[model samples]
Target: MFLRRAVYYWQLIAALLLPLWLFVGWGIWGGGAWTFVGVVVAAPVLFIAILVVTLIIYGRSEVRAANAVSWLDVALLALWHLSIIGLGCFGATGSLFAMLTVVTGLAAFWGTLWQLVRGFTRRARQTLREFEQLAGQTPPRGHVSSPEQGDVYVVYESRDQRRA
Candidate 1:
């Protein structure tokens, strides 16, 4: 629980910091010139991607109310975040981590999307079931509903009409 909640907030921070890391990492680690070009694109792309996944995860009511993500979310996001960091490092295994980042990012996206849809349907079904139970109920024995009322009007006569 502690870890899940922390990850939820961390993801929001990562959306900003990780992109900057990519640039700084590129400068420090001495990636190839074209890799710098790739970083130029990857930075914004990663920012938006992280935001998208984060928002989608947050879209679920349960996640919002609980202020935490599921275990599955933790796993996927942890992997994705690590992969992005590894990709930033630009070591010998950078490409491998890049591919892992893409795969895990997509998995996170689709996984959250499915959770949202599934939760929606599940809640809808539960509501429908409750409605059905209410429908099956009977009103209290002596309770009565008043009949509908039509509009009412009042008129006042002027002094001239009274004189007439």
Candidate 2:
């Protein structure tokens, strides 16, 4: 439980810090000068994707209520983040690993979105069921759903009175 909450928070901060790490890591151990060009493209996109995944997951009411990410979210995030870190290092071919990261990031997006849609649909179904139950309920012996059952008095005053 604590780990899930921590992961949720980390996902938020990762949006900024991970991309920065990619830039700094590459600058230090970059294969060549051309790597910076890739960083220029990948870093911003990575940043955006991180935020998007975080937001999509957070959009789930269950996550917000629990203040934690699901196991699936943690798994997808671990893959995506580790891949991003892999992108920073030059041990493997930069382009190859970068492509891997891109694919994983895309997967994360799709995964989070899928969960969001499913949660929303489930909640909507529950709400419709509740509405049906409510509609089936009969009112008590005396009920006043009509407005005329109650009387109201309006108090109107000139706006100029307050100005004085």
Candidate 3:
């Protein structure tokens, strides 16, 4: 279990770092610092953004408690895992590897956003329901009235009505 988490983050970090390394290595070979900054730094920054988004989603899931992970969260986690394989196999082709990384990262990004939106919307709805119920109470003004079956209801005009 612990190993899985380590591997997941390792893959994400590698996905970010490896592209930068390749770009910088190529730029050094070709004697162009501009390419190094434009390609190297940009690629990793984009990848790291994805990592941040995934962490946000995971953090929200943790906050929402057990079983709060939605299908989107699961899908993002799966994509994060798959990025390792994609990176390992296609790392030689920088463009293709970067594209794969971006695609997987986008999944993570949207997944987190979806989870957060869902969590907030759910909380808001719950609060609204509570407020509506409170507003609907008999004494809706200053104080809440406890439910008293006998005192709250009286048979005003029934054939079987009797004085208490």
Q: Return the top candidate by TM-score.
A: 1
Q: What is the C-alpha lDDT of each candidate?
A: 0.90, 0.85, 0.58
Question: Lowest lDDT 10-mer window, candidate 3?
Answer: 149-158
Clashes per candidate, residues 3 or more apart or on different chains:
0, 0, 0
Q: How accurate is candidate 3 locally (lDDT)?
A: 0.58
In model 2, where do residues sit more than 4 Å from their true spots? 139-164
Question: Over the full model, what C-alpha lDDT does candidate 2 score relative to the true structure?
Answer: 0.85
What TM-score would each prediction reach against the true structure?
A: 0.83, 0.81, 0.53
- Show where candidate 1 strays beyond 4 Å: 138-164
Residue lDDT tens for model 2, 16-110: 99999887897788556677777788788888888888899989999999999999898889988888887788775767777888888888999
Answer with 1 or 2, whichever has the higher lDDT: 1
Expressed as tens digits, the lDDT of each residue in 60-138 for candidate 3 is: 6443354244555555656654553444343356467557667877777776777788878888899999999888865
RMSD of 2: 7.4
User: lDDT score, residue 107, model 3?
Assistant: 72
